[model samples]
Target: MERKKKTGFARYINLVNLGVFVVVTSVSLPIYWLVISSLKQPVAIGASPPQYIPSPFSFANYQQAFSQYGFSQYFINSMIVTVAATILVLGLGSLAGYGLARLPMRGKTTIMLTLLVISLFPGIAVIPPLYLMMRTIGWLNSYQALIVPYTAFNLPFAIWILRNYFLGLPKEMEETGRIDGASPLRIYWSIILPQALPGLFTAGVFTFTACWTEFLMALTLNNSNSFRTIPVGIALFGTPFNIPYGTIFAASVVAVVPIGILVFVFRKSVVSGLTSGAVKG
Candidate 1:
């Protein structure tokens, strides 16, 4: 009777899991169908029910996006800006966060609150002055225009995340480093920073994604093709009258895959980083 009860419970659990799988698959099927439809030829794509798989699996859409839109240049530009910005945010933000967490100073709370408030403001709110400043510095239509602003705008949020994570860590670790004759910067670089890897990864990933997908600033700031990033280039798929759904969809998939992989591969670290000291403070 005991064995039979255990087997029955196992079967019930399996059935519940199968039901969940089916529901999830059902929800995702439409999205899969939409993406597959982009790879299909226009004639077949416009058909009544639409096809899941493309007939010939044509590379035409990707080819067109590359050739006509100069998407390759845009992709490279976006990659450069995103990577550089992510690095800056990680390095500077980590240090700033550490300082905010450990160092005592006058009006630190006021300064931190000010930063949080500024970060909460919408991009459009500051675009006019920011644009004029960029133009005055002659950074308009240059890589610096995009990368500098991307890093600066993202820094506040990154700092806050790192600060929170740092606050969670115990002070004993830093004391141990200092007892071993480590200076402030040395202690930060070797001890506290290393321990905050998870938070760093999480912040870096978020910053990278934000910079990668940012469109409004990229569109307005870069008028020339040479400085255009992926989001701006993707916008070209839609003219006044017509939109190239296939090319847009394919490029979007291309854009998303890397980010998806990045987060997926580092998910454990990101989660661990975010939740590391949640229970304490």
Candidate 2:
């Protein structure tokens, strides 16, 4: 009887795993098709039956996007803004999170709730004010226009994640550092921060992705062709009358490739942070 029950449990687990695999594959099909379609000739892309395989695969679409559409400059602009914003978000968020988690404070819950509310505001809602502010500061059409907003928008979630991770850590760690005559900042910088690697990586990845794909503010704040990012560059990938689907799809793939690599590289850290943050504190 016991062996049979165990066998039944194993079967249930297998069923659940199979269900998950099916769901994942179902969701991934469109993305997979988009990628494959980007490599096809324009004629093959518009074929009657839809060619799943590229008849004559070529990098023509990518070449057109990079050379004709000015994706190279846009890509560089994107990298600058995304990297700067991610760094700012991680630094500020981790510091703020550490303070909230470890330091004695009043109305901490209220403060945290306020931050959550701020983050909940839609990006569109703040565009007018942010645009005006940037114009006043002479920052319009500059990298700061994108970087600053990205950092501000991403900081709340970064802080929430880092604060939770910090709380989950044992107070004894800080106390032990204090016993060694270490300053609070020293403890955080030298000891606490190192142990928070997984959480940092998780927050960094989130901030980077958000900064990378952001479009509305990037569009609203900058009007110059020289300052456009990948999303904006891809959006303008055609004449007034014609939209090139294959070229746009290729650009889309290029836009997403960095994010995919980032996730793959730091996947273990992300999983660790998520698991630890979920259970601890």
Q: How accurate locally is residue 45 in candidate 2, as Cα lDDT from 0 to 100?
A: 84
| Cα-lDDT of candidate 1 | 0.86
User: Per-residue error at 236 for model 1, in Å?
Assistant: 1.0
How many backbone collisions does model 2 have?
0
Q: Which candidate has the top score in TM-score?
A: 2
Give one digit per residue, the lDDT tens place, for model 1 in 53-163. Answer: 788787777787788877789899999999999999999999998898898878888878988897998998778888999999888999889898899899998888888
Clash count (model 1, backbone only): 0
- Candidate 2 Cα outliers beyond 4 Å, as residue runs: 1-11, 278-281
The digit string of per-residue lDDT tens for model 2 on 1-281 reads: 99999999999999999999999999899999989889998878889898888878878999988888888999999999999999999899989999999999999999899989988989999999999999999999999999888999999989999999998888898999999999999999999999999999999998999899988998999879999999888888898898888899999999999999999999999999988962454
lDDT of each: 0.86, 0.91
